[model samples]
Target: MEEGKPGAVAKVIRRNPKSGQREFGDLVWGLLPYKTERPTTAVRPIHARAETVQELPMFADAFRSRRAIVPATEYYVRTETDGRAQRYVVTRADGKPMAWAGLWESFVWPGDRVERSYCVITVEANATIAPYHDRMPLILKPEDWPVWLGEAPGDPAILLRMVDPDVIRCEPVAQRRGNR
Candidate 1:
């Protein structure tokens, strides 16, 4: 799913400890299921800061127990220059799809209705993406996917740090296809 928009559904991967297997599920893009009582003006967050996911009230529980990964071939960022907006596509230098770190949660509304949603985790941008935006999604290395999915024992927070800049490359692109 593209950044800055909500309601997009994407495939998410997480570990099923009960079966010792990895499972795939669909999740709505913007997280923290909206409540009927919430003001119409309230905004739902689509991204969680990597540095604070473990402590923020909305993300803490999910950070500990529902970590996930969102696979992507590339991602886009927008930058404004002299009143004009330009888009840039960022991808791995190795030409491989990326596993973006994320968190998921299942919200139970009244009447036992359940909604599963997720938010991409972002950290301070590395050099490759710094010019386009101040933050970028945490892209995990293949070797660390098991750890991020909780298939192995390790600290997710440590894995959330910015990846080395050399692994990523960005290029300016024409206007994106959809309205976004």
Candidate 2:
């Protein structure tokens, strides 16, 4: 994780579209060549703050090429309470599936082998999420999905404006206190 990345990790796993894998969704956690020395867990940074995307080498080229969409039922973020850290789950106020703007990369290691992985792109929080955390995932709206998913060449400025305060809803959860 970098200085601006958020908590929780995500990976774009491969799903065999023709068989049982298709029933489970198109993702299966896999190892990456970019692991930070420790090989115990593959839980790498899932959310990278959008503001810092330019600084992340993995995202620099990936963002322009293999940009992806993470369809999440709900995503978790963290905050602080009484000097203790807490987590928060951000779901659609309408209770619909929402997609997080993400970038996927292929990490190949030595030994004539290869490992691949993916990460979600986050952005500065809107009014709905700022109180809970300084940043939130760059969620694209239904109408914007085409542009976000590369159907259109998106304007960075316009895309940045998508994180407006009006479109989101936030709630505080009691279970969040246990995350720390």
The per-prediction tally of clashing pairs is 0, 2
Indicate the residue-level lDDT of 93 in model 1: 89
lDDT of 2 by residue, 20-94 (tens): 131122322332325345534545556566776656664566556555666777766777789986667778877
Itemize residue pairs with steric clashes in candidate 1.
Answer: none
Worst 10 residues of 2 by lDDT: 22-31
As a whole number from 0 to 100, the lDDT of residue 170 in candidate 2 is 65
How well does candidate 1 match the true structure in TM-score terms?
A: 0.85
Question: CA shift at 76, candidate 2, in angstroms?
Answer: 2.7
The per-model lDDT (C-alpha) reads: 0.82, 0.57
After superposition on all C-alphas, the RMSD of every candidate to the true structure, in Å, is 3.6, 6.6
How many angstroms is residue 156 displaced in model 1 relative to the true structure, after the best TM-score fit? 1.4
lDDT, candidate 1, 31-79, per-residue tens: 7643325523435578999889889877888888888898888888888
**Clashes, model 2:** 2
